[model samples]
Target: MYGIDVITLVSYDQVQHTDEGMLSLSYWTIVGAYTVRGEKNDTGTMVDAVLYDIPSRKMLFRAPGTSRIKGSSTLVNLSEQLRTDSLNGFHLAADNLVTNLQLELDRFRKKVKAMPESYAIEHQPGYTGGGSLEARYALTLLVIGGFALWSSRRKEGFRDKF
Candidate 1:
């Protein structure tokens, strides 16, 4: 909505192994399983999608989906896994992409809305220019650490009293 007219699915990459149609599921399950054990996971499907925001000229999100099914020692099992994986991957990637993009957009909106209204550069009031900001920050950290250590020691005796 940020002056965006066209939102395009720039690229859709689906791994060749995903089974989209059960039409060939039976054929492949039998004929394809002969060498399933000999091969290593040639059946699983994976899809990578990139969304392009045309108005902003930015790539919004990339979602990748793949089969989560486990246990495939034989060709039959592997074929089944692949069939499931193909569908699983597409769904997982799409769902993840949408959720991730929503979170990202929310974060972006919060940041933009809360941006400081004005900006000005000015020197620190009591700075004699003896050391840089980095040095001062380091010293501040050391002081805080020392104080914490001192306070923690005081509580050591208090715990024994209870």
Candidate 2:
């Protein structure tokens, strides 16, 4: 098993489907059919995610996300279209869940900072805190330092020549 300190449980909270009846396509021409129409389907998905400490079984935070998808499909392809739309709705809901989870995590961190006594936090031995400088940032600083040195040397050379 993979080593994990916390576990996240995701569940589908709600699912809704609506049939909007036939939608007319007036602009398109059909060879055999006099009128072209499609059935409108709408699907809504809601997902909930809960974070918990594996060892202590303490609830950390909860996040919820929702999504809605509406599409029109011919009678022949209605089933397949509905299935694809349902999957898309779930995907969108999951994306929203990730965004909400990040926001909740930030709020949780603030809460922990504010009320340190309420939660027990511990770090493993040999744990060190540090800041990381990105490679692009470091390269930019080096280039700036090199440019400044070159400018100063150029000025010095000009003064010596005069």
Candidate 3:
């Protein structure tokens, strides 16, 4: 059976402060975890992910599409569709996050613009999370690896075919 998982956007950061700069964002998502059993290959699981920018509503990164169909060579239609559906769910979540962040930023800017110069409206150029892009990538890899291992172990002998 085909299933879609809804991923929530947990954390967000506005990386730049120029009038034309974009908002950098990070969040956790779980594309439907899958467990498949078939001839030859017993079981497997996969997780898909995507990263996006809030202000620009742009997709910054996406994990390579993956499916772990170990046995039978032929993929069951439901599993195939699950992959597409999961990706679509992620896209929708990213869009919603952008909309929410944009609305909040716009409101904040309006409030600041209405204030007098005495109330200095200072824009910080950078607000880092202590983790740079490279660090973030490494962290993501760690998370993916952890999950793959966890899922594999959750179901005995479910060799990771990712």
Candidate 4:
């Protein structure tokens, strides 16, 4: 919405390690010759992500997060456990990526504003002309008037709740 031409790039990938074997277990109970099968898992997952400002060619952020998941021995399904763990890891990593991107965007705007005009001397995205704030406000007022006229008769209250 601002005057600047903003370009954004994002990418992500997932990595899984099934060779690690069961990561960590919840609990185990043993008495004599009997033992309870606790939650078990054999795979670890992580998410790697990156985002940048294409126009400025500045590296915005990079994030990686590990998924914490446990499979139950009672379930007797290693594949299911791996799937659940991977999904959790992805979700966690996505959160990190989004948060970092937002922060970097704010930083980018401030950094651009503080720099001198010479900083953008070459290699710029195409121009994007737009009407000023006054024009936009006038258009908004026009639409509001049209809506008020169309919504209710002279004697009726406004259609809007407030």
Candidate 5:
């Protein structure tokens, strides 16, 4: 089959973070237009195609532009060529996308590795509930004192006297 040879792929992009927990793996496809000229024709119509991929960055399908060649010997067979060229573009796009994703994941891994496994808490209860009675009594007294102050402030409208 004789058809146009056009190749295209998605462009480079940054690692996107979305409001949802998961990040977005969005992609935009690029298409090249070519004129499928026959052995005797001076010019051929332009053909364009856009391909789509799944979330896993695998090609799902493609949507091609209109074809404007209808003749016995015009060599206007474009479906096969479109498929071939589009596949090539898809591979290139996938490779680039994977490289970028790997770089991003590496950064994340490094950050996680640098983080501390356990963080220290300034004040916490004992593991076996064996806290000192004096500390517990102090906490209760503090709570009661705070409540009294809060009640007094509420009764006075928390404002200066006129």
Candidate 6:
């Protein structure tokens, strides 16, 4: 009942640690020495959205988005930091996916207009397709109608005078 024409499927794929590095700090004094160590993690996420024709089961297009996040965390909080970074990466990638989807939609519209035979375009029952008249065309029609009305009135005035 919703009149759905196309279906979109989204997935998050290719998630991995794109980069890793070691972080270390050391301080030495006359009495003793202290050292700290940590790990730097870089996570990457890819989001893909595919649009398909429900009836034909044909793929219209695929839009892909990617994001990378780098952060340093102590060994005790490594897992928590990585989880936060992964969530952030997905959010950023999803945002980019939306932008890509819009661009793909515009491209698809232009393609359909350029080559109408490739796909079928239809409107649901009780829905009528319409086009708008340009401002100049409407203004010209209004001027012509007004002049015709004025001329008719002027001619009637001359007939009454005679």
Candidate 3 lDDT, tens digit per residue, 1-162? Answer: 222122323532221111111111111112211223221332322333454544446543343222233222112334554454445545554565556556655765676578755235333456455535777899999999999998878776554543
Compare the candidates by lDDT and give the number of the best one.
Answer: 2
The digit string of per-residue lDDT tens for model 5 on 1-162 reads 232122334343212111211111121112111222332211122233333332235332332322222221112334454444444445545554456556655764565467645222233334444454677899999999999999999879856655
Tens-digit lDDT string for candidate 4 (1-162): 565544444455555444322322322323311233344454445555555545677664555545454444332444666677677767866776667657766875687788856246443365344534577899999999988886666436544444
Instruction: Between candidates 1 and 4, name the one with more favorable lDDT.
Output: 1
Which lDDT values do the candidates have, in the order given?
A: 0.55, 0.79, 0.42, 0.55, 0.40, 0.78
Q: Which ten residues in a row have the lowest lDDT in candidate 5?
A: 20-29
- RMSD list, candidates in order: 15.5, 12.2, 21.0, 10.5, 26.7, 18.6
Ten-residue region with minimum lDDT total, candidate 1: 16-25
TM-scores of all predicted structures: 0.38, 0.61, 0.28, 0.45, 0.27, 0.62
Give the per-residue lDDT digits (tens) of candidate 6, residues 46-154: 9999999887889998999899887776555667878898999999999999899899989999999999999887877866457456789999999999999999999
Report the Cα lDDT for residue 28, model 6: 32
Better of 1 and 3 by lDDT: 1
By the TM-score metric, which is better: model 5 or model 6? 6
Backbone clashes, each candidate: 0, 0, 0, 1, 0, 0
**Cα deviation in Å at residue 137, candidate 3?**
23
Superposed model 3: Cα runs more than 4 Å off: 1-75, 115-162
Stretch of 10 with least lDDT, candidate 3: 18-27
Better model by TM-score: candidate 1 vs candidate 4: 4
> Which sections of candidate 5 miss by over 4 Å?
1-75, 116-162
- lDDT score at residue 146, model 2, on the 0-100 scale: 100
